[model samples]
Target: MDIFKELQERGLIYQHTNEEALRKRLDSGPMTLYCGFDPTADSLHIGSLLPILVLKRFQLAGHIPIALVGGGTGLIGDPSGKAAERILNPQEVVEQWASKIKDQLGHFLDFETKESPAIIANNYDWLGSLQVIEFLRDIGKNFPLGAMLAKDAVEARMSKGISYTEFSYMILQSYDYLKLNEVYGCEMQVGGSDQWGNITAGIDLIRRTSGDQVKEMYGLTMPLVTKSDGVKFGKTESGTVWLNAEKTSPYKFYQFWMNTDDQDVIRFLKYFTFLSLDEIAVLAEGVEKEPEKRKAQRTLAVEVTKLVHGQEALERAEKISSALFGGGLTNLTSAELEEGFSDVPSATIESPEIGLVDLLIKGEVVTSKRLAREAIENGAIYINDIRYTDVETSVSQLERLDGKYLVIRRGKKNYYLIKFK
Candidate 1:
């Protein structure tokens, strides 16, 4: 598919300057484009994935992408799209987060290649070195205060008030474009729809600050991804679904995608996966025909989970899901069994020795010792997957998996873990 068509198909392009001209330029040769991500958090949420994915798309289509970690701009928070002035984070915190964010992004881009390789840039490199006089005399002159104030982001805050720090956000962002253009001949910037103003500011900066001839620059923004029900995409009641496994576990991440609304599965597949249009069309058709089967949702979940994490994590999550929901647990490794059972309600036995009746009572699996004994007499309990008919049988840590965890199934779907620690 053509560049513009493919991007539009994937719901990537939101706004751009001169699409026809940009398309022509793109066809002629590789062009360098960049998107900046601030280090406001240690892990980038799904909100940030749109731009990162789009950048990867550009690279796959034979272009160089520069991912700018907002180490510098992060210190001076961007006021665009914010309701109120954001709490400024310490410079050291921002720096540390910036490093972490860059490392996460590294997994998605190809940096080892010499041809159209992706580059990581820190705006701090230039922003840190600028003297106040030089910044005011050079970059500050081009950005008129009136124009900056006229922006919606700024005007909306006029009632409350805008800080000098925030008011200068536009200038700083615009200078990023100018810097990219001057240093790397970067001709385009891409970001979410919220960044339109800052992107325009950047284009304006490049045009005014560059050589005698007005240089052409472009901006592209993706639409804000909001669910049909208006729930913010990629967030759960638990919190933001982070790309970092440590922040959001692989099982939780997989579950997030698996639970996507049937209506949103197709859109998410397009937005999140590298699958071709034809392939996604097939999945779309399946989603339409047999949504009850959740064919598309499962594929979307598996592909995205594997992409973000890895194949091994995807397999592990699948295994855990199967063991938890499919009533299948024989194949689970001892370690897998522990990870899967970690969150289940647990009752620990101080001395890993107890009668079946006492074990059931202690585990709260049964209401009382009488009921526990009756359950054992009725062959309702199992130890190590073996049916228990002996009311006097004793349970011990010897039956636990890896000598630590005991998988207890109270009923068909009520599973619990017993720890012997």
Candidate 2:
């Protein structure tokens, strides 16, 4: 199947300008396709995954992918999907975050080789240099104010008073397409479904500016991913699930996928993974036969985690997940154990010299040494999975896992993390 057909089947193609013609153009040669990442935050969330995956698909199909960092447009803020005016970060902060984002993209896209080596560009390179008069006359003239005002993002915020700067975002984005077309012959742009208006605007800009002197530019967009229950995708109880491991650890990232609802699993498999139709069909069968096993969910989580976090990180995340949820902690790596125990409630002591009863009292695992002794005597307190019967046993008797982390269980289901300095 052709690229467009495959995207449609995978639910990746939301809307494209002249889908047939664009597919024809893509088939003709190794075209340079582009996707813009607006550095709205320090790290990308799950919402941004669609475009990155699309770029990967284009690369796999022998097309060159140009990843655009929206250092300029991010300053102005695109109003495409916002309910209110975004608080613009100071330019310096945005620049810093943009650089960090560029670094983080390495985990997903390869930029080393010349043959389809992923190319990166910052829109600030061109946008920051343009003069106001030049912009108004040359670029602004093509966009009619009426058409701009009719957009959903603008119209929704119009009642709340959209700012002039926010209103002009489409124009700036259109200019990005024009510049890319002129400089690198970048003919295609990919974005989320909310960006349909902006993508078409860019396509029109390329047509108007180049005056049919070059090949027609293309726009491909993926649908905004939404959960079946109406909550937004990529969000957790805490907030956004970030791509940066520091912001959202690899284990949590994997759990985000592992917890996918049965209904959404198949669709997620298609949109996120490069797994072919036949392979997905097999997974679908497994989902039918044994929903309790959650085999498809595991496969989806594994594939996505590997893609985003690499094999080593994926393995660590899996180990952490199994150890925590499966209630078995002995096989966990030191890093995995640390990650699993990081958020649990715990207290620390300088040394293992204290007696078990006094340590439990001091560590606040029990209110008093008497209570701590009773719990241990009744087989309630576990030190490294062993029930300590002797209250006089020193804290040194506790077996430290990996020579650092100590898992303290208070009765069942109440766990505490302890680390020795």
Candidate 3:
């Protein structure tokens, strides 16, 4: 099947320009396509995953893929989706973020392959060198004020009073496309639905600047992902789901997918995983026939975790999950415990041994020794997954996991980590 049809089937295509020409271009032969990622943060979040996957999809289809890092344009943030002007980062900080994002982009694409290896380009390479006069005379002449004002990005921000710096962002992005087309023979640009205006602007800029020399250029955008309940995707009460392991541990990342709402799991599998349509359809049948088993959610979590964090990390995440839910913590490693309990309540104590009641009070797992004793009597207190019904029970180094920590559970879900210093 053609890439376009495949994307349509997977619900990736939101909007596109010149569909016939793009279809003909893809059918004729392999072509180069580019997607830009602005370095607004050091790590890309779940929101950025779709575009990166699109670039990978093109590369896997025997087409050249160019991943552009917006080191230059990030200085003047794109006002596509924001209601307020962005607080610009210092040049050094922007450079650091750009470098990190470039490295992260590499994980998704194969750069060493002999055929159509992925290319990474930074817009700063050429953008930082353009003179003010040259920019105004050569690039700025193509964008008229009325047309710029009419763009959805600018129009949305007009009521909020956008600054000229942000108003000029589309031109810079358009210039990026022109440069990529000239240098890398990139004929298509793909992004989220919010970037439809900017993507089309680039196509127009290339046509106007290069005149008859420029071949047909295309713009494609994927739908902005949202939850079935109408809330935004890729967010929890804590914050965004980051790609960096440090920012969001592989354990939490795996759980995020594992807890996917039954209404959204099948849709997300198509968008995020490279599984075949028939395979996904089978999972969909399981979702209906055996919703209680959560087969689809588990598969989604495993596939996505393995893709982002690799097999080793996925195994560790699974081990952590199983140990926590199935009472199998006897063999957890220190690193696994750290990742698993990274967000759990924790306390540090100098002594390696303490009475059960004292430990509960000191670790703030209970309000007072009286309450702790009551909980123990009621069989609600557990240490290292072992029920301790005696209030006088001592928790010593013998009960510590990895010889340095104790896992305390109050009732079924509340977990506390006690560190022995």
Candidate 4:
């Protein structure tokens, strides 16, 4: 099977310009393909994973890839997936976010590959300086009003309201295709399924502007990632699962995949991992026969976490996971402790010599001194997973985890953290 066929089998191709033509084109030689990433946020989330992986897949298949960071269009906002018009970000702020996003895209594609080193292009180079009159004459004239209004992205919001700034997004995105094609010989555009309208708009722009000078260009999108339960993928109770470690720690990132529903694990493996079809088929069988083993989920979590966070981070994440659920935080470093218990409630202690009951009261482990004493005597209070019954025992005597953090367990599952300065 060809590369496009491989994408189809893996369920990555949602829409393509033309299957036979794109396949013949792929088989012909190494062609340049591009995917746009708008820097609406400092870091890309798991929502952007499918297309980034697709770009890597094509690069592995011997095609040149262009990871376009939308420094320009990001300022304008693509109305494709928004329910309402977006608040325009300041230029400097958007530029900062664009640079960060460019760095994040580097984690996926190898820019140093000798065969066809990936290219990172920002649309701002051209869009930022284009005068209004020149833009209207050169780029905006190609887009007919009726066609622009007809797009599902625009039409969906017609009843509620749409802004002129957002309505012109498709044209600006179309110009991105024209600009890339004119400069880098990019023949294909890829994005999410929501971008069908935008991608096709770009394609049409190329067809009109190039006037048979450019060869046939194509567009493809990936399906929107979703869970069987109907909740969106890449989300937890905490918030979005970001690609940045500081935003979403490797431990939480690993846990997100580890908690994948049994029904979704195999599909996610196909979409996210570079594992061979035969290997994935075997894992699928394991999912069928040994649902309780959670073998598939574990593999998915490990593979994805390793891909996104690298080896050392993945190891730390696993160590954190083991320490967390295994009822011990004693072995964790200060950094690991901070990452694992980032969401847990925490209090600070000025001195390490505070009384145990007073520490409990200060940490809010119990409502009051009486409650703290009752819990301590009842053997329900645990300090660093060790039963601490002596209310008079100084906290300084207990060995602190990483010489600073105290793990307080009120009951079996309720956990709190105390930090010594």
TM-score ranking, best first:
3, 4, 2, 1
lDDT of each: 0.85, 0.84, 0.91, 0.91
Q: Encode model 4's per-residue lDDT on 115-191: one tens digit a residue.
A: 98899999999999899998899888899889988999999989989889888889989998989998999999998
Best by TM-score: 3
Q: Which stretches of candidate 3 lie above 4 Å from their native place?
A: none
Worst 10 residues of 3 by lDDT: 391-400
TM-score of each: 0.87, 0.89, 0.97, 0.94
Candidate 3: residue 55 lDDT (0-100)? 88
User: For residues 1-421, could you state the per-residue lDDT of candidate 2 as single tens digits?
Assistant: 3777788888888778886788788788788888899899898888888889888888877788888999999899988888888898999988988998888776677788677788889999999898999889988999988888887778888988889999999899988888887888888888888888888888877777766475577787888998998888998876889898888888989989999988899999999998898999998988888899998899999999998888999999988887776666777767787676655677767888889888777667889767887988998887676678888888787778888767778788677777787
| Better model by TM-score: candidate 1 vs candidate 3 | 3
Indicate the TM-score of model 1: 0.87
Give the per-residue lDDT of model 3 (tens digit) for 1-421: 4888899999999999888899888988888988999999999999999899988988888889999999999898999999999999999999999999999999999999999999999999998998999899999999988989999999999999999999999999999998988898889999999999999889888888886676688999999998898778999866889999999999999999998999999999999999999999999999999999999999999999999999999999999999999888878988888889988889998885678888898889999878998999999988889998987787763467887878989998999998888
Steric clash pairs (candidate 1):
none
Ranking by lDDT: 3, 4, 1, 2
Cα deviation in Å at residue 265, candidate 2?
1.3
For model 1, how does the per-residue alpha-carbon lDDT over 136-202 read when each residue is reduced to its tens digit? 9988899887888888788888888889998888888889888888899899999988889889989
Give residue 293's error in model 4 in angstroms: 2.3
